[model samples]
Target: MNASRKLTLAAAALALTVGGGLAVSSASAEPAAASRSLVTTTAWAKVAANGQILGGQGITGINKFGIGRYNIGTAAGLNGCALLGTINTNGGNDPGPGSSSILVGQVNGNTLFIRTATPSAAGSAAVDSDRPFSITVVCP
Candidate 1:
């Protein structure tokens, strides 16, 4: 299949999964509410190109090592978590224009490493660039 088709399918699946989870959680009663503490395992962060933390939940600190490189500290360890991130091109709290890409990974149990890049003029390679981004991490 083509990349567009694969991306479409993946997005649809994610939407369904998130929608279903929200439905199930919202429908549960008091007993289930007690177990909702487990939901705290999810964390998120919005950071600027200068590594300033704009807003986030369960995020402790954000450090900029250099251009296009950052380390995010979380309130809890993320030993077995799924990390997702995307560049922020929308102008607002985190303002930036043009297209960019981001890469997120776990550097340690409680730290996540992020790298940002922009496509080269020839569109043949990616060059490291400073860009704002948002990230989400879900741990089990």
Candidate 2:
């Protein structure tokens, strides 16, 4: 089997063993459910100086968390300039009732900043390598 599938199976088996053991020893004899969650999304796009939405992405998780990525193709703009953009959960629910978002990771760019739910505040002194970026948002 593939590495990804093997890892997933191993995790499930471990959860069952631990959870099942706890329940069997107790009066209820019902396995407790695991609550740990992990979600990931990846997208690719050729962003412009003004900022634009990234296409070709996927999401997998419980809630529809707002995530975005942009490519600031120019290197002669202010680092704090705000541009119009949108965050998409790709038909998923919002992160929470009042949860906020922030930048978690970045690459192939001089600097990438995400505030609130936009990615237009990025700035770089030099040209960016323009590679695909992945974002992961954890919700309570």
CA lDDT of every candidate: 0.76, 0.34
For candidate 2, write residues 1-140 as lDDT tens digits. 87765665566678787884322223333446766855322222222222333432222111212233342322323233322233334344333223233443332232334333322334441222222233332222
Per-prediction TM-score:
0.63, 0.23
Summarize candidate 1's per-residue lDDT along 1-140 as a digit string, tens digits: 87765665565567687884212232332123334425444789888888888889999888899879999999888987889999885476433334678899998889999999875423433467778899999876
Query: Clash pairs of candidate 2?
Result: 64-93
Report how far off residue 42 is in candidate 2 (Å). 9.5
Task: Give stretches of model 1 more than 4 Å off.
Answer: 1-41, 90-98, 121-126
Evaluated against the true structure, the overall lDDT of model 2 is 0.34
Q: Which structure among the candidates has the greatest TM-score?
A: 1
lDDT of candidate 1 vs native? 0.76
> What residue pairs clash in candidate 1, if any at all?
none
